[model samples]
Target: MATTKKYTAILLLLVILGCQKQDTVDNFPIMGNLPMGEYQVGFQTLFTYDLTKNAIPYSDWDGNLYQSPTSENGRQYQINIWYPAQPDSGTRLKYADYINLMGRQTNFGESEEQKTFARQTFITQTRNLKNIRDTENKEELNTEQLNQLLDLDIFARLDAQPAEGQYPVVIYPNGSSPAYQSITCEFLASHGYVTVAFAPKGRFSSGMEISTTGLEVAVDDLEFVLGKVSEKSNADMNQVSILANAISSSVGAAAVSRNEKFKAFISLEGGFISAFEQRLLNGSSFYKPENIQTPILFIYSPHPSIDPKYTSHLKYADRYYAHFPKISEFAMLNYGMFDEFIPDIIGAHSGNTKKGFETANELILRFLNQTIKGESGELFDDSFMSSRNQIDTTFVLPSLPKPPNMAVLKDTFWKEGFDAIETIYQQLKSEGNPQPFSMNFYTEYRDWLAWKKDEDYVYRSRLYDLAYDSYPKSARINYYAGYFSMKREMNEKAKRFYRQALSLCESDEDLSASEKSTLRTYASEDLNSLLK
Candidate 1:
C-alpha cells in the first residue's frame, strides 16, 4: 500500500508537469528593433568559421597578446556564426571547439596552473556579485551586480542572412564581458555583414577565459573565418574590417596594423595609444602604439562615471587622433544634461568630448555605409557632429525646468505642470537637464530661485502640474508626472501622464522594456478594474 501511494503521487506530479504550458518559443523577442524597419527572414545553415592557426602564440604563458604564426607552428583558430532564422523561435545554436588558456588545455582535467590562470580573467571575477535588496525589499541590482550575467541574450536577435563571394567580414572584440560579442554580431549580421565573433579556443561561451594564444588565435581565426565566409560566394572578402570595444580595441588595432588586408578598424570606447597605456597601468600591452597602422574610429561615452579615468592625463583618443591624422576619425557622443552616469565636475574637467552612443545597428550602419558602401553625403553633417559634442558635455546632466519668477511660478513653475494635472494635449520639448536640483549643491533653493511669476494657481494642486507649467516642452518631466500619479494610485491621472509621455517622446532606445511594458499593463489593468 505504501509503494502504491508513492507511485500514485509521482504519476500525478508527472501529469501536472506535462500539462503545464511552456512559453511559445516561436514568439521570441527581437531586441533593438526600430519602429520603422523592414525584414523577412528564413531558415538556413549556421555557417561556422574556422580558427586552427592560432593554437599557441604566447610563449611565457603570461596574460598578453600572442603572435600565432611565429610562436605556434601555424595558427590557432575558432569559428563564429550568423544563422538565418527567426528570433526566439527555437533552440539556440551551439558549436564545439578546443579552448586553451595560459598554455593549459581547458577541455577537461586540464593542468592546475592553466585552470588557475583561466580563473584570473577579469570578466569572470567582476560577474560574481552578492545579492542586495532594494527599497521594496526586493533584490536590486547594485554596483557589484552582474549586469553582464543578467541573461542579456534572453530575447536577443541571433543572425541575419547576408547577400552573396565570400562576404567581407568584420569582427568586434567585446569589452569586459564576452556578451559584447553577441551584441555586435547581431548588429553586423542585420546590416548584411558576416561577423566572426572571437572567443578563446575551448573558451567559446566563456569569452573571458582567453586561451594562451588569445590574440594570435583571434587574428588567425579571423583570417580563416573570412576565407570560409568568402567561400559562400555572396560575401566580399577584400573589404574585411575589425571592431573592438575597450581593451580588445587595442588588440584589434595591433592585429589589423600588421595585416593590410584588414581595410578598416573601429574602436568602441577605446584607442590604440591609450590602450597600451591602460595595459601598462594594468601591467600589460607590451607593444607600442606606433607599431599599429590601421585606420580607426572611436565611439565614446559621455558620462564621467562611465569613464572614471577622464581626469587622468591618459587622453588616449586625442593623442592617437593626433598621431594618425589620415587614418582616424575621433567622433564622440553627446549626452544631454541630468544624466546620472558621470558627475558634473569630472565631465567638465574632461572637456566632455566624444558623446554619441548611438544604437548598435545605427552605429554599424553609419560605419559600414561610410567605409564599405563608400557613400559620403549630408548624413554625416556638421549638425550631427555638433549634437554629438553637446551630448558629451551633459550626458549625465539631469532635466529640470526653470521659471522666470514667483509670479510666473504661480501660473506655471514646473515644465510639465499643466499636462500633469489634465489630459495630454501637445508634445513636450527639452533644451537641457530636467532635474535642476541635481545640477549643483545648494540646489534645494531652486524652487525659491524662480525667475517669473504667474497669476494662475500652479503650486496648489500637485507637483506635476507645476513642473508641466514651467517646462511645457519637457517630455521627461511629463513622464515623471505620469510615473508619480501611478505611484499615488491615481490610475486615470497616471494613464494620462503616461500617454502624454509616450506621445511626446521621440526616441525609444533610452526607455527599457520593463518601463514601457509597465505603462501599457497599468493602463489596461486600471481600465478593466474600473469597469468591474
Candidate 2:
C-alpha cells in the first residue's frame, strides 16, 4: 500500500511540471513582469557621422594598416538604443530577434551557423530572470512585462510622449561583445534610464571591422554617438553617463575622461590595469588624463594584473580610483567571483552572470540614479551590496578635496596629441604617403581650449595650417577648412571651402566608398546650412 502511494505522489509531481508553460526552449520559467521603471522601455537604432573625423586603417592579428588594406575609413557605427516607452506603442522586440542576429556573429563560438538555434535558446534563458530569482532580482518582474521579460523590446513601442518629460541616458560605447546581449541592457531600461550599446565593428558583427582600428577610433566614435542621440527629442543629453565591462571599460573610461558630455560613469570589473599590464597586455593608451572630473563608480573583481603589482605604480586599484572626493566608489567582488562554471564558458569577464548579474544590476541602478539624479549622498552612503560582495572603497587626491569648479577638463592632452600627429605627417610626407591621417583632433583641441575660456588660439591655428599644407589636395582638409571657417563666422570662406571639398570628394583616391559618400553628404550640408 505504501509503495502504491509513493508512485501516485511521483505521478502527481510529474503532472504539475508538465502543466507549466515554457516561454522559451531553454526552459526559463514564466515571470511576473513589471516596468523596469515607472516607464516602459522603447528602442530604435541611430546612425550618425563624425564629419570632422575620418576613419583610421584597421589591422588584425595577422596584418598592419597598409598591408591588410582593411580600414574603417567611413567609420559608421549603428547604436542600439532603449529609452522610456509608451504604454501601448510600437512593435515589441523578442530576445530571439537579437539571438538570431547575434548568433550568426563570428565570435559566438564554433560554426555559429550550426549553433544558431541552441545559441538563441541559451541567450533567451539568461534573460528570463523572473522565474529564477538569481542575477539579483530586487523584486519579481510582473506578468505585465508585455513582450519582454522586463521592458527593452527591440524597436518596441514606448511612451514616445512620457508624462515625466525626458530621462537620462547611459552610453556603453565599444564593447567587444555583440550588441545582442539585450538582457544586459534590458536591466537598465527596466530602471528608467536609456541604455545604449554599439554593435562592435570588427569582432562579432559583420559590419565595418574597427577592432584592429585601435582604441583612438573607438573613443572618437563615441562623440558621434553622443551627437546623434542628443538629436533625439526624447533623450536628456544633460544627464548622460557612460558604462562598460571588462576590456571595453577602458574605452568608456578613456572617453568619459576626455568628453564632458558624460556626467557620471560606471566601470564594471574592467578599467584599471597596472602600468606593466597596461603595456605588456592591454596596450597603454587608456585613461591618459592624470585626473578625471566626472564622478565614477568602479565595480570590479581582483584582476591579477593591475593593483598591488610592484611595477604597476599603483599600490591598490584604489589609486586609480583616486579622482573626485565623495563622488567615486570602488566595490570589489571576491577574486574569481564570476569565475564560476557556466559563466566561465560564456565569458568570465561578462557582467551578465546568474550568480552576480542581478546584484551588479542593482548596484548600477542605485549608483546611476543617485549620482545622476540626486543632490546629495545617494550612492555608497547606504549599503549597496549582496552577500557575495566583499569590499567597497573610495579615494581622492590630497590636493583637490572637491572637484575643481572648472570648465570641463581645462587642459586636455589633445594639444600634445596634435603635436604627435604633426610628427607623423612629416614622416608620411617623406614616405610619399598622400593621406597622412583619417581624422584631425586639432579642432576638438581648439574647442576644448575655448571651453576653458583661453585667449591662446595661436598654437592650434598654426597646427591646423600645418596639417592643411601637408594634405592640400585632400578632400578631408577642405571639409575641415569649411568647418573651421563656419565656426569663425566666415560664411563666404566656408562656402568656398565647402564647394572645393565637394569637388575634391570625388577625387580622393585613397578614400573608401563609404568615406567618399560621407564626405559628399557633409559638404552638401555645409553649403545648405550657409544658404539657409
Candidate 3:
C-alpha cells in the first residue's frame, strides 16, 4: 500500500509538470518572434491601377463573380511595401493591423459595407486553413486561441518615416494569404531592403488559375509592380531581385527569363522543383531557362521524392540549392503557429519551426547580399553551412555549351542539297545529342525551306519529312507535312498527314487557339483536295 501511494504521487507530479510546460510554451508569441536586423521596419499600403490593361471581372472564393458598383478602367493592384525606416517612438503595428489591410485590398475606394464583408471573408478563410500542415493531421484552433494570434505584436511600424538611402528592391509574389511571408518581408526590410508583395490574381478571376494563361497573368502583375517600384525615389531599380515562394516561383522563373532587369532570383520552397510544375513551365513560351543569366538560390526542405539533380537544367545561371532537414514547405511561412507547433503537431522530422524560420531568413539575406549587393564574403561557403547541422548546400556554376552554328545548317542545305541536311541530322542523332537544336529550330528551318520551295519540291518534302519524324505530335509540323506532300503529288500521304494533324489538334492542349484554327483550316483544305 505504501509503494502504490508513492507511485501515484510521482505520476501526479509528472502530469502537473507537463501541463505547466505546455502552458509556458503556449504563452510565447504565436509566430515565434524572429530577431530583427539593424534598421527599423516601415510598412505602407498603396493602391494603383495599371491603365495599359483592362480589369476583368473577378470571382470570389465560392466561385461567385463580384459585381462592382464603380467602374474599373484597368487592372487594379494593391502594393504592400516594407522598407527600411527611421526609428520612431510610436507604437508598432500589431498582427491584427496587417490582417485588417486585406479587407481594403481589392475594394479600396468602395463602400464600408463591401470592406466589412471582405474583412470577415478574409478572416474566415484564414481560419479555415487549419489542415494546411498536411492532409492527415489537422490542428484545430478555437476563437480565443485565434484572437491571441491576432493580438500578437509584430515589428513593422505603420507609415513610419523612410530611411534616407537607395536600397535594393525585393519583389515577392504572395501565395494564398495577403499576409503571407510577412515575417520574411519585415526581416528583409529591417536589413535595408525595399521588399514589396502583392496579392496575385488570375486574369479573369480573383483565384489564380493553374494554366499557361494564368502564369502569364501573374508575370504581368509582377512586371506592373516592378514598374511602380521603379518610381520610388529610394528604390534602386538596377539592383532588383525577385524572392518567390511556392507557386510564385513559376512566375519568378518566367519573369527572370524575359526581363534582364532582375539581378537575381530566389525560390523559397519553389513549386517548379516538382515534375508537374516542370511540365507546366516547359509548356509556356516565356519559360526559357537558357535566358536566365543571373544567379539563383533555391531554399527547400529535403523530401525523399524530390531529386535535386533536375535543378541542373538552368545551365546559364550560377545556382545554389540549400536543403533544410528540419522544416517542411508549409512551416516556412508564418501561419501564426506556436514555436513548438510544427514539431509537436506535425512530427519530429519537422524540427523546431522557430529555428527553421530564422535560418531560412538568414540564408536568404546572406545570398541576396552576395548576389545583388555584390558583397564579397565566404558567407555561403560549405564551412558556414557545416556549422548548421540542419542545412545542406550545393553550388552549381554555369555550364554553357557552345551553341552549334545553326547558320551552318542553312549554308550546307544550299550547297550540298537535302541529302547533306539528312546526313548531319543522322550524325547528331547517332551521337545521342539533341541539345544543339530545339524544336523551334527545326520548325523555323522547315518554314524557310517552304519559302524556297519554288527551287525544288524534293527539298521541301525531304525537310518536312525530317521535321514530322522529329516532332510527331506537333500539329503545325503535321499540317505542313500534308501541304508539302500534296505538292509532291503524293495524295495518299497528304491525306494521312492531314488526318494526323487534326487528331493531334483535338488531343493536345498546348497549341494556341489561333494555331489550331490555322492547322484545321489548312489541313482540311488539303484533305478535301486529295479526296476530290
lDDT winner: 3
My TM-score estimates for the predictions, one after another, are 0.40, 0.49, 0.70
Scored by TM-score, the top model is: 3
TM-score leaderboard ranking: 3, 2, 1
Residue-level lDDT of model 2, residues 281-326, one tens digit each, is 2333344343345666656554445452321321111222311111
Report how far off residue 493 is in candidate 2 (Å): 53
Ten residues in sequence with the least summed lDDT for candidate 1: 319-328
User: Residue 92 deviation, candidate 1, in Å?
Assistant: 6.7
Give lDDT tens digits, candidate 1, residues 1-532.
9999999999999999788543232332223232211222211222232334333333222345533232233333334444233333444321101112222322222466543444343223222211111122223223332232232222223343333324456765432222334434544555556565544332232233342244444444455555655665555668778876544655675566356577667765564335332443232232323223334554454322234243133211121121111111122111111112322211223332212223323554565667666767533355544543323221111112332323443345256564432222112224332322111111222344333432232322255554666554554555656655665667677667667666655544334567566545654565455346
> For each candidate, how many residue pairs have backbone atoms clashing (under 3 Å)?
76, 18, 0
Query: Which scores higher on TM-score, 2 or 3?
Result: 3
Show where candidate 3 strays beyond 4 Å: 1-35, 54-71, 89-91, 109-129, 132-140, 302-306, 336-349, 392-397, 401-532
> lDDT of all the models against the reference?
0.40, 0.50, 0.73
Alpha-carbon shift of residue 282 in model 3 (angstroms): 2.1
Candidate 3 local lDDT, 1-532, one digit each (tens)? 9999999999999999877522121243543545556887788877888787767554665667776642376777889888988887234667766666665555566456654665566455544443444446444445565466567777777888889989999999874444557888888998889999887788776667777777888898889888888888879998999988777888888899889899989988888677667777788877766667788888888765455565676765778888887777656777424435433333234466667777788888999989888888865676667656667555555544423445787888778876887887767666654443455666667667768444557777777787777778878778878888888888899889999999999666657788788778888887987888
